[model samples]
Target: MSAPEQRFTPVLLTLPGLTPTLALEILPHGVTLHRLFVQADGRTHDLLIGPENPADHLTQKYTNTIVGRYANRLPVNQDAFPLSRNGHSSTFTPQSNESPTVSLHGGRVGFDYVEWTPLLDPSESQLFTDAEKSHLNGSDGVVGVIFKRISEDGEEGYPGRLLVETLVSLVEPSGPQAESVKTGSELKLGSVVIVYRAKLLDEGKVTPINLTQHWGFNLDASLKESLTVKEHTLSIKADHTIELNNVGLSTGSLLPVTGTHHAHAEKESKKIGEKWPTSGYDEFYVFSPRSTPTLPTRVPVSEFTPTSDLLKEIITSEASSKDPLVQLASEKSGLRVSFDSNQSGVQFYSNNLTNEKNGARKKIHGGSGVSGAGDSYGVGSAAFLEFHEPLAAWLNPSTIGHSGNDTLLASGEIYNNFVKMDVWFKSPVA
Candidate 1:
């Protein structure tokens, strides 16, 4: 196990009868998500960004990796577009030379730098039925891990031949709702669930898959000082976004985040160091619905309730009906993170160029990167919430003029997406 100890091999996921224990880490370069320890009220907190070794996630080029076959940007030569299948035609270049203008995430060796293949299952009964122990709040059983990969076809340039799958479970919370998620009082919980499947082995052509998992959170794992994520405290179920352009791409318009431009505006829950020196946040908000004329009811996916009392607006709920499109908290380490997605846009990056003079992050279309120290990283330090599909359904499916918006993946179709995470704290006497 050399080669940097086989590239920091360590895939843990403990949560079997969780209560004061909640571990997470699935790293093998690109399957990334380094660590997430938690221990609730008695206070433990390591919520995320727990990697300082193993090359420290190579200074964030795709930090918690898993990027895409088309995660973020796309548009090449003469604003490329058009990928006909059974009739041939293809044109949406920049497959990966490292980028100087177009295809960002999924061009240069896309799938987050590659390296996957792990299908774990460590069990011994640890049963749970009683309606799965009343929606896990009791704490008894569940530990999963499935990270397979295979992008062949046209590799990063984008085409058919794809087969990606990722599942990182770790549940156990159901003793009659474990005192409402172990005393947050009632609802604001998640043991962990991140599924994302993809399959399209060219049964006749037609491709365009967008996946995301650039998870980067830093809940003050303190090391004396320097733990500023601008003091953390944000909530976004999206009131509208995706309007970039000026070197950030996405000019398909669709504004209104409460009057745009303040880093793409935000309706409430503010305070990420007071919205930064201004030019941070990358863009793309919009929760669901890609058509039916800008969303005329088709946002259904809520009812997963499991309350018990103790609701102060459940801490400003908003993930679009399902009530958790994205919410981050850190009232001085009382940690709180919630994100739910069926995927229809949710970029939000504020790592703003990862420092070390910014160089060494190449791969816009080329390959090989990882330079260093640009103050090691500034403003907020770490922040991202990618969730894919619908940046105007791939650049411009009429840019939201919507005609039953179709982001292509044709032939038999199947390119699933899932993102649900929950971490607690905020009543341990803060």
Candidate 2:
């Protein structure tokens, strides 16, 4: 690794005059990534794609906000299959998978739809916590938040109880190359990493869990014509695979992504086995194995193709987020997630399915701002960089049952919180 030249001295962003209420839809999560309302050359573009009124129903909608208690899909229900986090548990079916059996992105309503009670400050908006956590650890500028969910028995159908807390923090980036003055552009630079840490407190029973975000993004820089990312390149770093069950469920089944699994076979771009592709790159390569007390510096980040001396890719890319706006994740490991203190597999999906004409940010009247266009589906779109300690990595049915509880820690062990990472959106100088 090389030493960085500058570090990002983060300037807290806050809305002036606009009601702390304007940012309501984004609260409880932390900072809101709003489309800066701007009009240049006699044109108007509100990067956020919203209307003059009722923001939800307007031309612009969908913010890649923070979500959880548990993210992605649980493959069960928060009501029936009670999970054990924070010493209690619940069960709930999710909406992420094609199969009803999978808990996809927090059982339909997870945290996305609901309104979060806001506690506004000048620079940062403190979220609603039935107590989520807040603190300073190891570093003074470091601040941590704990979002906990205590479940009633049989809330999702499974047994045992649950208490879950996801801790998210902002730390000053250190290193010879720590500062980015501009982001995702070739200007003066600095680096600021937004870290999300999670800890689960569970009751006495084994539970199968996976969490990541659905933060979708579009990287095509041109506003007039939609682009296909097939030409974009990708590379995954992990060499091993964890065998998952038929439903891709992993309470305790461990294996690699290289198998007869539907995803492996159905998706050609999945990059399974040793066959690497210069194009159509989409798949999860396991992060280097980390048992515990792992240093963030030591773990090998994913690699990319068209290798650059600057990037730490387990995977590599011809596509540079610096130009043409590539969307790489640890792949949405972008929404970093830690669990039971155990680190597992992370998934990476490209927005091959993004349709500006028919997207979540549709505008009839039109919209556009930070990303450029003033119409419905404008420039530089969002990316879905998800994160989670995959159960698939730990699920090994042969060792245990389909339950896949092969770990010896029993039901009450401690799992470090999940971590959410965003694009540092690097600038030039640092």
Candidate 3:
């Protein structure tokens, strides 16, 4: 119960060359990802959904926020989970800033709500080289920013002093991808790459850590119309899901998607409306360890099962390590967002709680378009797709059911991960 930290101004990262360029806002508060703008079809549209200001939320919910210390959840009951290393054992209590029932998003004062400092002169802390920059884009000009923070030992009742660095870069198309722009044969696509690196500052002390960008996206340019995400089409490459309990906690069961909306969607894309009967998608899709990592096959964005009135763009694959774990397309704008990550799993949460205010049902307008100091925010206004380590990996390290890897961030080891977002838009014939 200490006073809350002061919020800082937002910083913008933009790619200026592309017609419909990409822009992102990096907020000092909670090191949050605030605003995202993509130039598509002769228009620049903001794609993120949440309150305009960071202080208006009754609950942080980590909207477009950087979540960690431990990203997801760690089970802590009457008999807390036991942790042992080098003959030392400790119990993780459910104590958190979130709720007494569980430890959510690094407890009450988790990094999401706290002020994060950027390293002095990001240019001095440049982690990428000319070759690395060239790999991102052939363009002479590229833009990037690096933010860093130090988590004191036991800051959130977590062990070890942890140092985290995040780099947000807007790299334009390169090689063949860049050539298509001149030919006007292919839809231009640029990337917003997030690089995360963390290390344990205290020797011989370990911590369970997971980090993610809680991104909720909507592709529409005109917000005057009442928009619901039900019309969006989605495709996920995985075949299995990590099950969840009623309150959004993992049940430690890796189950086949089967007849559910969370099924393996590589062959075909499905509409969001089809899953209306359920609580939307709040499950983790597991990429099989047996599968080879390779570049995704390109296809028309329109191939994601577009409806006539809604289809505004075509989908094409980027040269990524694998096909996107999740592909979301809007028929209205032809704006398609493909999400890829090195993390073990992806969490999709339909902004189902936007309409709920102070625990009651109410209509509140919130998103990048409107101020969110109101009691209620936009309900189902967008969809949150999170890239991170598997849920409950800390509780059941051996049984968390990630493809093949475990979740423990050992002492003296660096945890490096990244998430990529590719936005493609198609214009109507003049």
Q: Which ten residues in a row are the worst by lDDT in model 1? A: 292-301
TM-score of 2: 0.49
Error of 3 at 392 (Å): 1.5
Query: Which regions in candidate 3 have their CA more than 4 angstroms from the true location?
Result: 1-6, 16-20, 54-60, 78-80, 84-91, 123-141, 177-186, 221-223, 293-322, 356-376, 397-403
Better of 1 and 3 by lDDT: 3
Model 2 regions lying over 4 Å from their true place: 1-26, 29-98, 115-153, 158-164, 167-169, 175-208, 217-235, 240-282, 290-342, 352-357, 362-383, 392-414, 420-430
Candidate 1 regions with alpha-carbon error over 4 angstroms: 1-39, 42-166, 171-195, 207-234, 237-252, 258-335, 338-344, 347-386, 391-422, 428-430
- Among the numbered candidates, top lDDT falls to 3
Candidate 1, position 29, lDDT: 70
TM-score of candidate 3 to 2 decimals: 0.80
Return the TM-score for each candidate structure.
0.30, 0.49, 0.80
Task: Report how far residue 60 has shifted in candidate 2, in Å.
Answer: 10
lDDT of 2 by residue, 36-86 (tens): 222212233232332222333222322444444344334543444333433
